[model samples]
Target chain A: GIQVEQSPPDLILQEGANSTLRCNFSDSVNNLQWFHQNPWGQLINLFYIPSGTKQNGRLSATTVATERYSLLYISSSQTTDSGVYFCAVVNGNKLVFGAGTILRVKS
Target chain B: GEEVAQTPKHLVRGEGQKAKLYCAPIKGHSYVFWYQQVLKNEFKFLISFQNENVFDETGMPKERFSAKCLPNSPCSLEIQATKLEDSAVYFCASSPQTGGTGNTIYFGEGSWLTVV
Candidate 1:
């Protein structure tokens, strides 16, 4: 039962602003993922970076496995990105998720 | 393309009634998972299947919850005698690897179950 904690439970920013969200896990993990739960409640896969850096459009993520931490960076945020950002890790057969960081981007 | 599909975006049932939800994993995926997201709580794993076989169901409430993955059909999770606490968003996810880093798990728009 590894614990995953997300920082800054809530975040608010204006459109076009950049922000960083962090996730810290308490144990080793075989896989790490960042998901965006949009307003429609769709969990969109953003990245599957277990121990490296990955970038996709305005979103990027980096996982430092040794340190048991991961960071997600969003640049030029849009209203569409206003929702919950979750980070999940695999602890054996099951994947555990954090409570998630609630992001609100105002236009 | 890499997305899981769930049916009946919303479900409402009376207390003590049975609630069933269906999930269709992405094509070629071998692993399917079911999770419950209660209010103010993180997603909790309920069960997982590896091609019709129950891989791990330790998280499932053995009392009144049951799940099945029929051959060539969408997997289903049924909750018998549903209660108010069972009212939450149920999410289904699928991945190519059972538990590997290549594990790009994709989830569907969860099915919200409201039991009154």
Candidate 2:
């Protein structure tokens, strides 16, 4: 099994601030995904970047597969962005998730 | 847009009772997975099926947790003699197929179970 670790386990910022979250995997992975669990407990897919970079709205993610690491960038944070961010990677047949980074945005 | 549908948004049961959760994967998806998240914490992989066939269940409890996927029907995850620790939000997800170099999966809203 592969071990996934997330950094800055907890983060807090003002609405207009910016932040970056990181994920590191112990082994090679075929699939990688970023998820946002909202206040209501709904898990929303943020990105499916196995490699390279992707952007959606104010959020962006970059995966360096060779380095076995990924970075998620949140710009101009908003109150709606307050939640837990999870980074998961496929290890063999099942996906293993990280401990997650809890982010809070103050209005 | 594709989505996984989970039934019974919330469930409450006794410690010794049985709890069953259902998930309907998106059309044409062949891989279904079940994961349990306790109090918005770490995700514990339970089981997965590749079109009615168990693909990998290494993380499953094996004794008290069982799951099944049938043709044209929703997949079901059943917990027998559930314990207080079994209370969590169960998430279901589906991908187009297995063994692909890059596969993107879609997850359901999740079913929250409360065991007293």
Candidate 3:
């Protein structure tokens, strides 16, 4: 089994600010994904970066597979980004998830 | 469809009752997975199927939990004699076959189950 740990278990920020969330895995993984669980309880895919970097709108993610760590950056954050951010890695055929980072952005 | 479609966004069951959730994976995706998320925030894998055959079910409970993905039908997760601890959000996901690499997977909106 693989273990995934997310940093800064909880976060609060004013709207328009920036933040970075991190995930570290205990073992090698071939698939890594970042997800945002909105207030409505929807798991939205933010990025699928097993390695390298990718950006979509105000969010970007980088995965250093060799280091077994991944970083998710939110630029000019919005209140809509408020929720739990989860990083998960495929362990065999299942996705092993981190405890998640809760983000709350104030107006 | 481009997204995984799960039925009955929310369900309520009493202890000892049965609960079932359904999921239709994105069209053309051959692999389907199920995961459970408790309010405490940890997501646990439950089971998976490739086409109509079970793939990996190491995370499923010893009893009362079962799942299936048959041809031309939506995948299903069934819980028998539900307990209070069975309350959680169940997520269904799918991925294109990527050999053994276990590539990217997309998740549905999740079915929220509450047991009383």
lDDT by residue (A1-107, candidate 2, tens digit) is 79999999999999999999999999999999999999999999999999999999999999999999999999999999999999999978778899999999999
Worst 10 residues of 2 chain A by lDDT: A88-97
TM-scores of chain B alone in all candidate structures, in the order given: 0.94, 0.95, 0.95
Could you give candidate 3's per-residue lDDT for residues B96-115 as a string of tens digits? 98522556788999999999
- Score chain B of candidate 3 by TM-score: 0.95
Find the 10 residues in a row with the least total lDDT in model 1 chain A.
A36-45
Ranking of candidates on lDDT, top first: 2, 3, 1
Off by over 4 Å in 2: B99-101
Best by lDDT: 2
TM-score of each: 0.96, 0.97, 0.97
Give the best candidate by TM-score.
Answer: 2
Q: Report the C-alpha displacement of residue A49, candidate 2, in angstroms.
A: 0.4
Q: Report clash pairs, candidate 3.
A: none
Query: Candidate 1 residues A1-107, lDDT tens each?
Result: 99999988999999999999999999999999999988877788899999999999999999999999999999999999999999999988778999999999999
TM-score of 3: 0.97
Across B18-105, the per-residue lDDT of candidate 2 in tens digits comes to 9999999999988999999998989998888899999888879989999999997899999999999999999999988882237888
